[model samples]
Target: MAKLILDTFREGYGVDQIRKTMTVGELIGFLSDFDEDTPVYLGFDNRYTYGGITEGRFEMDYGEEDDE
Candidate 1:
Protein backbone atom coordinates (compact mmCIF):
# COMPACT_ATOMS: atom_id res chain seq x y z
CA MET A 1 0.00 0.00 0.00
CA ALA A 2 1.10 3.56 -0.72
CA LYS A 3 0.53 6.64 1.40
CA LEU A 4 -1.33 9.51 -0.21
CA ILE A 5 -1.93 13.08 0.88
CA LEU A 6 -4.67 15.10 -0.78
CA ASP A 7 -4.91 18.87 -1.01
CA THR A 8 -7.47 20.97 -2.81
CA PHE A 9 -7.63 24.50 -4.16
CA ARG A 10 -10.37 26.62 -5.75
CA GLU A 11 -9.51 29.69 -7.75
CA GLY A 12 -11.65 32.79 -8.12
CA TYR A 13 -13.27 31.46 -11.32
CA GLY A 14 -11.37 28.39 -12.33
CA VAL A 15 -11.91 24.66 -12.26
CA ASP A 16 -11.65 22.82 -8.99
CA GLN A 17 -8.06 21.92 -8.20
CA ILE A 18 -6.82 18.83 -6.42
CA ARG A 19 -3.31 17.69 -5.67
CA LYS A 20 -2.03 14.47 -4.22
CA THR A 21 1.29 13.40 -2.85
CA MET A 22 1.04 9.98 -4.48
CA THR A 23 -1.38 8.31 -6.87
CA VAL A 24 -4.03 6.21 -5.18
CA GLY A 25 -7.32 4.63 -6.26
CA GLU A 26 -9.36 6.07 -3.39
CA LEU A 27 -8.20 9.55 -4.26
CA ILE A 28 -11.23 9.93 -6.50
CA GLY A 29 -13.57 9.56 -3.52
CA PHE A 30 -12.33 12.88 -2.22
CA LEU A 31 -13.64 14.64 -5.33
CA SER A 32 -17.31 14.02 -4.62
CA ASP A 33 -17.79 17.74 -4.09
CA PHE A 34 -16.97 18.36 -7.75
CA ASP A 35 -18.67 17.15 -10.90
CA GLU A 36 -18.33 13.53 -11.83
CA ASP A 37 -16.77 14.13 -15.27
CA THR A 38 -14.80 17.20 -14.43
CA PRO A 39 -11.33 17.39 -15.91
CA VAL A 40 -8.54 17.13 -13.39
CA TYR A 41 -4.88 17.92 -13.48
CA LEU A 42 -2.60 15.65 -11.51
CA GLY A 43 0.97 16.49 -10.72
CA PHE A 44 3.73 15.37 -8.38
CA ASP A 45 7.24 16.20 -7.35
CA ASN A 46 9.52 13.33 -8.23
CA ARG A 47 12.71 12.39 -9.95
CA TYR A 48 12.70 11.24 -13.58
CA THR A 49 14.40 7.89 -14.01
CA TYR A 50 14.88 5.36 -16.81
CA GLY A 51 12.61 6.29 -19.72
CA GLY A 52 11.80 9.74 -18.34
CA ILE A 53 9.31 8.40 -15.84
CA THR A 54 9.12 9.82 -12.37
CA GLU A 55 10.54 7.55 -9.70
CA GLY A 56 11.44 7.83 -6.05
CA ARG A 57 8.93 10.61 -5.71
CA PHE A 58 10.16 13.10 -3.15
CA GLU A 59 9.60 16.70 -2.24
CA MET A 60 12.11 19.23 -3.44
CA ASP A 61 14.73 20.19 -0.91
CA TYR A 62 15.79 23.80 -0.90
CA GLY A 63 18.29 25.52 1.38
CA GLU A 64 21.94 26.38 1.66
CA GLU A 65 22.89 22.72 1.73
CA ASP A 66 20.85 22.04 -1.38
CA ASP A 67 22.55 24.91 -3.21
CA GLU A 68 25.95 23.30 -2.83
Candidate 2:
Protein backbone atom coordinates (compact mmCIF):
# COMPACT_ATOMS: atom_id res chain seq x y z
CA MET A 1 0.00 0.00 0.00
CA ALA A 2 1.15 3.53 -0.70
CA LYS A 3 1.97 5.64 2.34
CA LEU A 4 0.34 9.05 2.57
CA ILE A 5 -0.10 11.90 5.03
CA LEU A 6 -3.25 13.90 5.47
CA ASP A 7 -4.79 16.90 7.15
CA THR A 8 -8.43 17.29 8.19
CA PHE A 9 -10.70 20.28 8.02
CA ARG A 10 -14.23 21.34 8.91
CA GLU A 11 -16.61 24.24 8.53
CA GLY A 12 -16.81 26.43 11.62
CA TYR A 13 -18.05 29.95 12.18
CA GLY A 14 -18.38 30.30 8.43
CA VAL A 15 -14.77 29.37 7.94
CA ASP A 16 -12.72 26.23 7.39
CA GLN A 17 -10.60 24.96 10.26
CA ILE A 18 -7.98 22.26 10.65
CA ARG A 19 -9.31 19.42 12.74
CA LYS A 20 -6.59 16.76 12.57
CA THR A 21 -4.17 14.70 10.51
CA MET A 22 -4.36 11.12 9.32
CA THR A 23 -2.66 8.44 7.23
CA VAL A 24 -3.76 7.24 3.83
CA GLY A 25 -4.07 3.63 4.88
CA GLU A 26 -6.16 4.55 7.87
CA LEU A 27 -8.36 6.70 5.66
CA ILE A 28 -8.81 4.10 2.95
CA GLY A 29 -9.63 1.47 5.52
CA PHE A 30 -12.21 3.67 7.11
CA LEU A 31 -13.65 4.64 3.77
CA SER A 32 -13.82 1.07 2.60
CA ASP A 33 -15.93 0.18 5.58
CA PHE A 34 -18.42 2.88 4.73
CA ASP A 35 -20.96 2.75 1.91
CA GLU A 36 -19.91 4.23 -1.37
CA ASP A 37 -20.88 7.86 -2.22
CA THR A 38 -20.27 9.09 1.27
CA PRO A 39 -19.18 12.68 1.37
CA VAL A 40 -15.70 13.47 2.71
CA TYR A 41 -13.11 16.17 2.98
CA LEU A 42 -9.41 15.89 2.17
CA GLY A 43 -7.01 18.49 3.40
CA PHE A 44 -3.70 19.48 1.90
CA ASP A 45 -0.88 21.87 2.64
CA ASN A 46 -0.42 25.05 0.61
CA ARG A 47 2.22 23.26 -1.43
CA TYR A 48 0.01 20.14 -1.79
CA THR A 49 2.62 17.97 -0.18
CA TYR A 50 0.37 16.23 2.39
CA GLY A 51 -3.30 15.32 2.41
CA GLY A 52 -5.84 12.74 3.50
CA ILE A 53 -9.48 11.82 3.20
CA THR A 54 -11.76 13.92 5.37
CA GLU A 55 -15.24 13.67 6.78
CA GLY A 56 -16.36 16.91 5.21
CA ARG A 57 -15.42 18.28 1.81
CA PHE A 58 -13.63 21.59 1.46
CA GLU A 59 -14.48 24.23 -1.12
CA MET A 60 -13.10 27.56 -2.28
CA ASP A 61 -15.46 30.56 -2.29
CA TYR A 62 -13.20 33.08 -3.93
CA GLY A 63 -14.99 35.47 -6.25
CA GLU A 64 -15.12 39.08 -7.43
CA GLU A 65 -15.93 40.31 -3.95
CA ASP A 66 -12.62 39.02 -2.69
CA ASP A 67 -10.79 40.19 -5.78
CA GLU A 68 -9.06 43.57 -5.56
Estimated TM-score for each candidate: 0.23, 0.28
Q: How do the residues 2-68 of candidate 2 rate in per-residue lDDT, one tens digit apiece?
A: 3333353344654334355456797678769655755444445543654445447556668566553
Question: What does candidate 1's lDDT look like per residue over 23-48, in tens digits?
Answer: 45555567665665554433234322
What does the lDDT come to for candidate 2?
Answer: 0.52
In the predicted model 2, the residue pairs found to clash are 6-51, 41-54, 41-56
Task: Give Cα distance to truth, residue 27, candidate 1, Å.
Answer: 1.9
Q: How well does candidate 2 match the true structure in TM-score terms?
A: 0.28
Question: lDDT for every model?
Answer: 0.41, 0.52
| Maximum-TM-score candidate | 2
